[model samples]
Target: MRARFEKQLLTLHQELIEMGSLCEEIILKTFKAIEKEQLPNTKTIATLSEEIEQMEQDIESRCLKILLRQQPVAKDLRTVSSALKMVYDLKRIGTQAYEVSEIVAQGHIVKSKELHVLQSMVDSVREMVTMSIDAFVHEDEALALKVIAKDEEVDENFDTIKVLLVECFASKSLDIEHAIDLLMVSKYIERIGDHAVNIAKWVLYAITGQLDIDGGE
Candidate 1:
């Protein structure tokens, strides 16, 4: 029974990693659409989003089954529960990525300084998503802490983008509709960073059995 339980746990980790990869891919597609000033195929983004949602449901069912059949204890229980919570954040990240792509498809084009800051935000956010899942897969608390710390950089980038957009508005360089779309995209990116932080915290919980919202600091 114990050996089977362990195998199930490994399967859970593999599924989580797969779902995280899908999240990363969808976000990158959105970033490319925005950066290159090209309209992404909305159907492709929608299909990715649907796949993410299906993964979330499948993982949730697996976790529940493990809990019912294996009746995990202590750290084992924590690991399974953390994954159940983690999938929700993963789903949210995928949903927001799709939303960002939709906004870009609607002719929202960023340029110059704002684009540079936005690029930094995308890079940081993608790293956080990847590292958070890595931390969970390896049970590495330190890496999870790093992902939580990185959220600050994403937050700062959002602030810088907001300031630059406001300045453009003041100088009559950007119209209100375009400014709103850019702001919406940045806000979604900020929320994705927050979701990554949540996943990292869950990683710490699965390892230490304590959920530290402040990155264990």
Candidate 2:
């Protein structure tokens, strides 16, 4: 029975990794859509989002089953509870990617000088998503801490994009409507970064039994 329970936990971890990989897929697709100045194929992004949402439900169900059947105590309970919380972050990341792709469908995410900043932010966010999952997979608190620290870079990148867009607006150098759309994309990417940080925080909680109360761990 113990071995069977352990296998179930292992399967849960693998499913979480698959969900993380899907986030990687859609984020890369969204960035490429921006670079090409074209609408992202909504069908593709939607499929990914649906899969992610389904995984969240499945994982939550499995966690409940493990809790009720195995009655996991101590660290095992912490791990299962943390998985439940982590799925929320992963689901939100998928939702944000869907929003980004929808903006692409709107035909307004045109070529912009500020796109390079947006690309950099997306890259940072992608890294955060990947590394945060790695921290979970490896149970490495130090790696989890690094993922938390990296959120600052993503935040600064978003701020730079905002300032540049404001300057463009003030100088009458950019279309107001398109610039607004671009800001929306930047904001979505920023929120994705926040979700990545949240995942790392949960990973930390799983390992350490607590999150950094002040985000200073």
Tens digits of per-residue lDDT for model 1 on 1-217?
9999999999999999999999999999988877787887778988999999999999999999999999999999999999999999999999999988898888856467787888899999999999999999999999999998999999999999899887988885567777888889889999999999999999999999886664321
Model 2 residue 15 CA deviation in Å: 0.4
Q: List per-prediction Cα lDDT, in the order shown.
A: 0.91, 0.87
Q: TM-score for all predictions?
A: 0.96, 0.95
Error of 1 at 117 (Å): 0.6
- What is residue 81's positional error in candidate 1, in angstroms? 0.4
Model 2 weakest 10-residue run by lDDT: 208-217
Report each candidate's C-alpha RMSD, comma-separated, in the order given. Answer: 2.3, 2.4
Candidate 2: tens digits of C-alpha lDDT, residues 102-157: 87688876666688889999999999999998898889899889988998998898
TM-score of model 2 relative to the true fold? 0.95
